[model samples]
Target: MGGSGWRKAIRGFNLCVYSPLAAEGGGDVGPPGASYDPPAALSPPDPPALQLPTPTQSSSGLRPRVSASGSGLSKRTCAICLTTMTPGQGHAIFTAECSHSFHFHCITSCVKFGNHVCPVCRAKWKEIPFHVSSDSPRARSRVNPVNMNRRHAHMSFQHPLLHNLEPCIFNDDETLDTTFKTSGVCYNGSINTVEIKTYPEYSAIPESISTDNFTILIHLKAPLGPRNEISSKNVYVDAEDSRTHRAPVDIVTVLDVSGSMSGMKLALLKQAMGFVIQNLGPLDRLSVIAFSSTARRLFPLSRMSEFGRQEAFQAVNSLTTSGGTNITEGLRKGAKVIEERKEKNPVCSIILLSDGQDTYLLSPTLHNGQHTQPDYRSLVPSSIRDRTVHNVPVHVFGFGSDHDSISMHSISETSGGTFSFIEGEGAIQDAFAQCIGGLLSVVVQEMQVRLECLHHNVQLGCIKSGRYASWVTDGRRSGTIDAGDLYADEERDYLVSVNVPPDHHETHLLRVSCVYSDPVTKEVINPAAVELKISRPELVGSQTMSIEVDRQRNRLQAAEAMAEARASAEHGELSEAVRLLEDCRKRIFESEAAKSGDQLCASLDAELKEMQARMVDRQHYEAMGRAYVLSGLSSHLCQRATTRGDSTNSGSFTQTYQTPSMVDMLQRSQTFSPATRQSNSKMRHTLSFPARPKPR
Candidate 1:
């Protein structure tokens, strides 16, 4: 009330506790002018219920005074409790910006519980007058029956690990539970700021499921909220640039310097490495590994200081093509460099580029002098044979048509990374720039999701979590999903199929919980679990469906179709691949996503059409279409937006790369000079969308 923004000379009063029963009573608590005798000493043992005395007259024998500032107190009633207010008594009137007046205690009690809006007009209050004392009767009385019911449901059983954690509620109901009214529903305001919400495709399933199933879509994201200054740094995140803090990255560039990369390929690789080295700041560390028949470290893991950049330049320039391609060795050596780093940065990854198959694993029996046809199965690299290379992701780049895309795609997918197909002469640098851009903008790391069956009758089914790894545990009653690192504002959708049995009782089906580490604060956050409940109504009622759930289902189905098409094309079944792509496109058009004006559907439709056009013949698919399809599918499965097709076609990666002559001049003139350091250090590309088929 004392702030400069105060517009009225209104009196503020100490909040008084009111009984819910009194408020619920019909307007005849007593006849007009009737007074009830008060009890002797107020006892704190029971809830204090202050009843408003009739405004006919006061005990002091003073009549009420009327003022223009407020409608006379004798004629007014409290909006919340619907009780008369007497003038010159203890009660005071409070007015909001909308000119609606209420009892001081009623409005203050509402605002104290985080309801910053006027109860009558619902206008938001910018500045509240006084602080709420936690030990006040009004504050204690705010806990109504709604919150008590929710507490009973939430505390049914608590795990030792998550005993005191708050429960995440759906909050669509208007009952206004105390906890729901205080904090925004989905946002728990927990240690981790990321918001995780789950929605079942169908709100209510049939009670008698003779042979029926349901797929639930769970979404997780870091909400873009108001900006706050934490520790002398603004931690606010925006939609476009939501990086809370950039974690220092330790990256290894794995180059395949085989005979095939002798010409423009080698030149482009060096240029890409040069751009990467120039772009890194002093906080980031880098290493270089080049491989031919064997692999060796070209540059040790060192910070990107002035001296370190110069050393990296020399190491990149010394690269020469020789012997055969050894992609396995290159990836192994790259992973080793990161694991052997003396000082570990919070974020670490390896960038592997290969233009041919791994000859190290190809051993053809030599009956005569010439070699027989190599076993196709042996061509699959051993790096991904164990289903994962290492904890650090190896973002593999398959250069040109000859690169072993199956192995490259598997390597990146298995290691929780993305696969980029460098088809054009100059796309190597663009791909590397895109990869490095994602590494620099990482916001959350080491994310894990745990989904448990809340009901014994409810059964768990397959969970489609894209490229992230997931496994079922405890006799299929529980499961864990390894989501890995997420960039700023990135959202990953998971479609979990579940089976329900015919039961008379309504109960929760599953509970989802997320655990992640904030890259900036380095704090481990474990948010409360969200439940997916279902009801068995005897007579089915009209139920509203979530469009987002349908859209995610279409996305996964399209990804599966793309995978099937890619496999068909790889096996020389061009006609079948084209048919599959066409079918997927039609399904996308017919899906709810298309009707909802979702951009993802339009993008997928365009990509599927282009893919169908390219799948005309086996020769075309083998030349350029295979890698392109694999890369596109990889982008969709990982839920990470990536640069797809030619850089000219995809306007997202339009930054021009320096030519060979310009690269030489940049290296000689100290490219990352003080003046240019700031520009180079700024992240060029910030991934704004989840993994999709087209560039964002």
Candidate 2:
């Protein structure tokens, strides 16, 4: 009852509203002596300005303290610590590698404590400028870098970190061979239809006035996914080593004139020797080591000329097979000949040819009163490989599939040399010529190609670019392909499976980088990059792939498949290997990627014929596998050899190995001609972009 009485009394109690509108006489909203008015009639006082909490940044990984875009110097705020770059606030700098702009103090702090990688792209960050040669020609778009952190108005040319560094691979020699050649799996004869892009969305620009860096070409073929499907991107990075500088080569041919090479083999050897002699420039030197029961230097290293060449021809022909095969003696004498020029540091090569295993060996025979160095390890078929490890290279060719491949292969592999196998009875000559071609194809001494994936969607499977390449490395973010010694106008293809993004537009994917040591100067070259872009079917009306790309892609895929097939065949799966090639042919046939189906079909038929030989004869298979591995080239690669005779008879098949012919490109301009398509006339096309304010 008491609680109910208190509630009733509280309800009956009177109260006055307290607001700005309250009046003196109990509640009509008005000021004293003025008309009553509501608080809404008066302008609402602005609420206290909203204050946001400061965001936090974790300090674990590389985080950029700078932004990507900017205005004039000091006109922007620092992205790191929420401070402007105006006047006393700080100054800023831009890195071309990642194209990120940052305040001096903030970026310095980031570099010192925030790890060395770029915040945006996470690329290796360097503080110094490119340090281009003052005498070097600069691009019209290039501007002198500004130093905004300092008070001085002048530019400093002294970049201590990069000073005295020579142009690792810069040249203006337009006469270098630029023709892009390939063994056709699709289009052949000329590279006319190949579309080259410096970057997607840019027109093809000719390299008239250019920088001295390596030229990189990107061939993109983005297919239209089956209606409304987001299409995947297909890109190929084609890099050309345009710097042409000839270095002197000193060669020592170790020929096996054993009894097995008495007739056709001897004649082929003579022909192969003649071919080598014919291709040698006057500056090049050659020495022959004829080995039978005994090894002797037929002639010391001699300069080739009309008269000298004649004498060499007579000397090579003079070699007649009689005694047992002494391969160890041949290698020993050959190494001695090249080791003679170790001090001169000439490009030394030891080319060994043998048809049978080493059958005889005396301690170390004297050739022209000089004992063979180190006695070829005093063994049947062994040599001191250390000499050829760096300065000289030992290339071995097993003829007729009877030679000890284990011994010959080990010799070449240890010496950074190439090992090739010539099958059948009389193909030794062709094999020799091909060996010589490969020997002469040394442009970059120590070369490595890296594919850095720019986007997370794409990656590559690393494969050895050549048998001569040391090794292929798989990295966390990139694939490193070992490209041993690149030849003049020699194009090597690699197949990498790209995981396409789930249908995106305006996507940029991979970056190809080349690092090599120049043979002429021995300078380590690095930082060559090619940005790859693709045209998605969604962006373009029709999906069309040029003959050049179409053929190369097919060849690359086929080559990779053949490689797997060869491996499978070696494991006793002959049908699997043949199936690989068949599958490749079927795909090409269905797609109509080949310019001439008959030509490609003929090539396939020839390929299948060889592969079928491997299936029937284990010896043939071993020979083919050994050669394929040594060449580190595709199945379509038959340029070094010319075959004649029935494919079934290994003895009847004759091969003459020779370097591929090169097409010279004289001029590159806007003019259109059939010759331009065939030759290496690299017409550069400029990229399109809106004009921007010039930088100081």
Per-model TM values vs. the true structure? 0.60, 0.48
lDDT of 2 by residue, 1-696 (tens): 110010000000010010011112332111222221111001111111111111222343112122123211232433222223455523444443666555443343334221354432335666533333435453112222221223222322222112123222312111111122221111111111111133221212222221122122233211111110001011111223222234446788888888888655664466456556645544467877888887776655665533234335445534556788888777777766654442332356788888787776534568789975433234422334544335465767777656665566556666656556665543444445445544543445555666666666554433323343433244435666555554444455443433435334444556766666545456665644677755344333333444444554555555566678767776888777778867876776665456455354445435545554555556666655545443433223322232323223442222222223211110001011111122222221111111221232
In terms of TM-score, how similar is model 1 to the real structure? 0.60
Model 1, span 38-81: residue lDDT tens: 11100011112211111121354221122334322223554443
| Per-model C-alpha RMSD | 27.8, 35.5
lDDT of each: 0.57, 0.43
Distance (Å) between predicted and true CA of 259, model 1?
A: 3.4
- How far residue 278's Cα lies from its native spot in candidate 2, in Å, is 4.9
